[model samples]
Target: MDRWVGKTAVVTGASSGIGSGIAVGFANAGINVIGLARRTEPIEVLKSQVTGSGSITAHHCDVSSAEDVAATFKWINETFGCVHILVNNAGIFVTGGITDAGDDMISENDIIAILDTNLKGTILCARHAIASMRSNNFDGHVININSIAGHYVPMSSKFNVYTSSKYGVTGFTAGLLNELADHKNKIKVTSVSPGLVNTSLNVVAATTTDMPALRPKDIADACLYVLSTPPTVNINELTITPVTERRL
Candidate 1:
C-alpha cells in the first residue's frame, strides 16, 4: 500500500526494538522516515534495512532533552517540508518496587527520570509536531507507544516507575484525543498499549515471568493499522498482548 507515499514520518527511539520496527514499516509503505535516537550506529543499521523505495534519515537526538528535540524537528521540517506522522516511542523501563529487594527500591530520582523521559519527552515531541503540523495545515497523526501496564499494573510489586509513566502516557493520549475532537481538528491521536514485547527494554530484567512475549513488529503492525484508517475513523486505543499471557 502506497498510502504513505510522499508523506514524512518522525519516529523516536528508532535505533532498536519497536521504534525500529515502526520505522521499517513506514518505510516499506513508501513514507519518508526520519528516525531519532541517542545512538547513531544502530539507527544507521536500521536505515540500511529499509526497503530502499522510501527515504530514511537517522538523526541522533536524546528525546529526554527539549533542546535536542526542537533542533531535530527543525532539521526534519527543513528537509522534509512537513511531517505527517509522529511516533513517540522513545522510553526507558526502570524496574523497581515501592519497597524491597537489592537495588529494587524505587528512588525519587528514578521516578523523576521516568517522568522526564517518558511523559515529558512525549509532550515535548507532540508539542513540536503539532506546531509544525498546524502551521503547515498538515493533517497528521500522533501515535504514542504505551503499555498494558498503563491500564492494569500486573505484578504491581515490581516496576512501579515504569507503570506510572506508562499510565501517564495513556492519560495524556486520551485527553489529547478529546481536545483534538473538540477543536474539530484533522490531526489523529491514538495510543497503543502492548504487553511484554520481546525487546531490549525487558531483556535484562526479570520483572515479567511470562514467556512467549509479543514481538516488536506486533506493535508496529498496530501502529500501521491506526495510520491506515480513514480520517473520519479514530482508533482511540489498541492493546496487543500475548494470548497466553494472563498477566497482561
Candidate 2:
C-alpha cells in the first residue's frame, strides 16, 4: 500500500454502486482516481464530499462507446502518465427477463447496451490501460468487476443477458492472462466476482431486495487486498458472496 502513494487509477462506472465505492477507497489511499461514466454528476458530488490526500476527477464517458473510451484514455495518458491501476467496473443490466417485452421487455438495443458496457467495455479498458503499463514499464494491475452470476445462474434472478455478459468477462479475464503472458508483460489481471451486492445501480429493478447482500465497500476492500499482495502474487480470480448468499 505504501508503494502506491501517488499513482493514478482509472475507475469506470464511478457514478454509483460498487464503482463509486472503489473510487472513494482509492482516493482515500492517496491515489489519484479518474472516474469515468455516462453520468459524471454523482462522481462530482462524491469528489467534493471526500476529504482525502488523493483526488477524484470525473469524466463523461460511456464505456460502450469506442469514441468515448478512446478519448478518455487519451486524456488520461496526457494528464497522468502511464496508469498504475484500472478498475473496469462500468456495467448495465436490462430489467425483466431475456424474452421480456412490452416496456418491461429487453429490446435489441438493450441487449447491445448491456453486453457492450459489461463485456466490450472491460475489454477496451484493459486493452488501453495495459498500453500505458507496457510503455512505462510499470507493473500495473487491471481489476475486472465480475459477478457470481457469471459463474452460476441463480433461480428467478430475472437476469438474462446480464449473466452471459459476465460469463464473457470471466472468459476475458482468462484470455487476458494469456495475452499478457504471450507478450511477456508482468502486468497483473484480476477478476473480482461479487455476489448479490446491495447496490442501487439504477439499472436493476427498484425493489427492496431484502436478501443478504454484500456492500460496495466490501468489493473495494477485496480490490485493495489484491493490490496489497506482494508483486510476486497474482490473484487470478476472487469470488465474494455474503455469508447467507445462496449458491445456485
Candidate 3:
C-alpha cells in the first residue's frame, strides 16, 4: 500500500456500484485515480467527495469503442506518463435465454452488448494499459472484475451469455499470465471474481430471493487487498461470496 501511494490507477465503470467503490478505495489509499465510464456525472460527484492525498478525475469512455479506449489511454500517458494499475470493471447483463423468444430467440443486440463490454472491453483496456506499462518499463497490475459465474453457472439459462463472457475472462487471465511470463514481464494480472452483489446491477436477484448478497464495498476491499500485496506475490484469482450463499 505504501509503495502504491501517489501512483496512478484507472478504474472502468466507475460511475457506480463496485467500480465506484474501488475508485474511492484507491483514492483514499493515496493513489491518483482516473475513473472512466459513459456517465461522468456520478464520477464527478465522487471526485468532490474525496478528502485525501489522492484525487479522482472523471473521463467519458465507452470501453466497447476502440477509439474511445485509445483516446483515454493517450490522455493518461500524456498527462500521467504511466499507469500503474487498471481495474477492468465495466460490464452488462441482459435477460432472456437463447430460446426465450421462441421463434425470434434471444436478441442479437443483447448478446453483442454483453460480449462487447464484458470480454472485448476487458481485452482492450488491458492491451493499452500493458502497453503503457511496458513502454515505460514499469511493472503494473491488471485486475479484472470477474464473477463466480465465470467458474460455473449459478442460476438459469437467461444468464448464458453473461456467464460465457465471464468464462472468457477466466481464460483470458490465465492466457495473460502466460504471455507475461513468456516475455519475462514483471506485470501482474488478477481476476477478482465476486458472487451476487447488492447493487442495482443485481436488483432482480435481490428482490426475488432471500439469499444474502455482498456489498460493493466488499468487492472494493478485496481489490485493495489484492493490490497491496508485495510485487513478488501475484494473486492469480480470488472468489468472494456472501456468507449465507453456498459456493457455486
Candidate 4:
C-alpha cells in the first residue's frame, strides 16, 4: 500500500457495483483513483463521498469502444502520469435463453455487446495499461474482475453466452500471464472470480442473506489483497465464493 500511495489507478464500470467498490477502496487507501464508466454521475457522487488520504476522479468511458478506451487512457497518461493499477470491472449480463427465438434475449447484437465489453474491453485496457507501465518503467498490477462462470458453467438458462465470455476471460488471463512471463515483465496480472456477487448485474436481485453471494466490497478487498502482495508474488488466479455456494 505504501508503494502505491499518490499513484494512479483506473477502475472501469465505476458508476456502480464492483467497479465503484474497487475505486472507493483504492482511493480510501491514499491512491489517486480514476473511475471510468459510461455514466459519470454515480462516480461523481462517489468522488464526493470518498474521504481518505487519496482522492477520486470521474471519467467517462465506454470500454466496448476502442476510441473511447484509447482516449481515456491517453487522458490518464497526460493527467495522472502512469497507471499503477487497472481494475477491469466493467461488465454486463444479457438475460435471454440461447434459444431465444424472438431475439430478445440472445440476439446477434446481444452477443456482440457482451463480447465487446467482457472480452475486447479487457484486452484493450490491458494493452494500454501495459504500454503505460512499459513507458514509465513501472511495475504495475492488472486485476481482472472475472466471474465464477469463467471457470465453470452452472445449470442455468440465459447464461450460456455470458458463461462463454467469462471462459474467454479465463483463457485470456492465462495467455496474458504467459506473455508477461515470456517478456520477463514484472507486471502482475490476477483474476479475481467471485460467485453470485450481490450486485444489480444479477436480474434476480439476491439481497437475502440466505442466498449465497458476495458483496462488491468483498471483491474490492480481494483486489487490494492482491495489490498489497510483494512484487515478487503473483497471484495468478483467485476464485471466491460464498460458503452457501454449492458445488456443481
Against the reference, the lDDT scores of all candidates come to: 0.84, 0.87, 0.91, 0.88
Top lDDT hit: 3
- In candidate 3, the residue pairs with backbone N, CA or C atoms under 3 Å apart (3 or more residues apart, or in different chains) clash, namely none
lDDT of 4: 0.88
Which one wins by TM-score: 2 or 4? Answer: 4
Runs of candidate 4 exceeding 4 Å displacement: 101-104, 204-209
List the candidates ranked by TM-score, beginning with the highest.
3, 4, 2, 1
TM-score of 3: 0.95
Error of 1 at 110 (Å): 2.9
Worst 10 residues of 3 by lDDT: 97-106
Distance from true location, Cα of 139 in model 4, Å: 0.5
In the range 6-38, model 4's lDDT, one tens digit per residue, is: 999999999998889888888888899999999
Worst 10 residues of 1 by lDDT: 203-212
- C-alpha RMSD of candidate 1: 2.0
Candidate 4 all-Cα RMSD = 1.8
User: Can you write out model 1's per-residue Cα lDDT over 1-248, one digit (the tens) per residue?
Assistant: 35568788999999899999988878877888888998868877876677747767889989889899899889888887888899999998776666666666877887787888899999999999988999899889999999888897776556577888888999999899888889989898999998778898864234546466888888888898898898688898998887786673
How big is the positional error of residue 14 in model 4, measured in Å on the Cα after superposition? 0.4
